[model samples]
Target: MTDALERALASLDVRAGSTRRHTLPAGGDIVLPAGSTTLVYLLSGEITGDLALGSGCEVDAPTGDGRPVSGRRTLLAGDAAMSLGCRRLVLSSQSGAEVIVVTAEITPSEIVASLPGTVLVTGFARLEPAAAALAGNLGPRPDGLACERPGDTVVCRSMIRSVLLSAVRAWASTGAWPAPIADPFLARVAAAVEADPGHDWTIDHLASLAAMSRTVFVERFRDAMGRSPAGYVTEVRIREAQRRLDAGASVSEVSRALGYASDEGFRRAFRRHTGIAPSAWRARALTA
Candidate 1:
């Protein structure tokens, strides 16, 4: 099986639509009304920020009096506020700071939903130690400015998504997997499933991995994933197939590779899950 981290990273795209670098002096502040998904990477200096996702507000490292905390970190926007109207993002610095803000093609909700947790809720949280390293890589490349190079924005987007996913997994490991799926044993089971969705996963096999009975595993899996074990497997299969289709694989090729009994069966399953045939989805994805 591929490493779980690799699989999770493979499941997301971070292509950027735009990128800009900013330098802020001490006491500098900026307010961005939500529209496009944004990632603010603090290149240097201390800063504080807040995220207003709808009426719910989350401040990064706020002080006793409820002021935003000052520290260098990464900020990810959750919902762009297109449907909800707009989120308020506030950033301030006590000292000078440099940041590169990138607008992604996809929203925070889309990224979070693809990952295992709601860790992107605020889209304004600090990155984990491991994720911090990846975020740090977003600093100016030795060759030249990132935006100066062709296709560099696309690469930037992938790196940002990677950093977010790493941080999310770290947060979830510290106790964020929901409900019945909160058990460490079940988390491992979930990881294995994601690591190799094409595996012939049965309730008994998954239960053994979790050291639980078939019935217990089934119940917990549904609670954590909101679906039966079989249902989850089907979803994973379809998602993998979707990724392949988007990458330009033929319908027959995807059907065979994902272990579908037949091409027609694969077509039926894909349509049932995505409301579009694989070929049609591919066409739309290519045009998109």
Candidate 2:
């Protein structure tokens, strides 16, 4: 299960946007806007909040003992909270508190969809010490010199990435996400697709690999994976394209490697899956 989550996290394209520190006075509440992924780590304070989720949103949180907790409403010092696809987040502090909030845009949407809409990790400092260490050093500089020095952006981004990774690892450890493909035959088909995403995957070929008839394979694949084989193949290809692009591969190179007949074909498919052109995506990743 951890391996599957690692693969999913590896495929995600996380672009950290801004990191801000907020001080909430007693009885004050703040409303965070929607869009992108948001992480809130309590530096030294207490907060209570409600998440307004739009359609298709899911929420999960784990307590200090790594047990799943539902409808979590409060966060204490050393706790970390995350939300995606929420209409807005309303947080209020009964006693004054301070927090560091980071915003990021993570893609492809399918991968984000697979994650819970909200994740609150209690005792984050103990559960993810490395991330806690990084977070401890993050905030507005005392002199108000924000990212003004050489390599500051890169260093800040690296810290944000580490913190985000730790939060995800914590959530995944609780076994809250969906289970992996259960059927052995379907699992084999998924493995093959992932192994060679550029292959000319057809229903017949995949069914043959699974040792099942085409109709049976299609039905079972959808049942186990929640999508048709062709859809899964497209997803796998797009995931690979994101990975390669983030690794500094050119658009044409990724196109050819993914078995697309032309750059335009790959561009269209990539846009359809990720809602952005591959080149633009790569550029954002580079600057991020």
Best candidate according to TM-score: 2
- Residue-level lDDT tens digits of model 2 in 66-89: 433444378899888887846577
Give the runs in model 2 whose Cα sits over 4 Å from its true position. Answer: 1-3, 34-36, 50-68, 85-87, 142-147, 151-154
For lDDT, the strongest prediction is 2
Off by over 4 Å in 1: 51-86, 107-111, 114-196, 199-221, 242-250, 264-288
Model 1 vs. true fold: TM = 0.56
Pairs with backbone N, CA or C atoms under 3 Å apart (clashes), candidate 2? 58-117
Question: CA lDDT, every prediction?
Answer: 0.57, 0.78
Q: State the lDDT at 218 in candidate 2.
A: 93
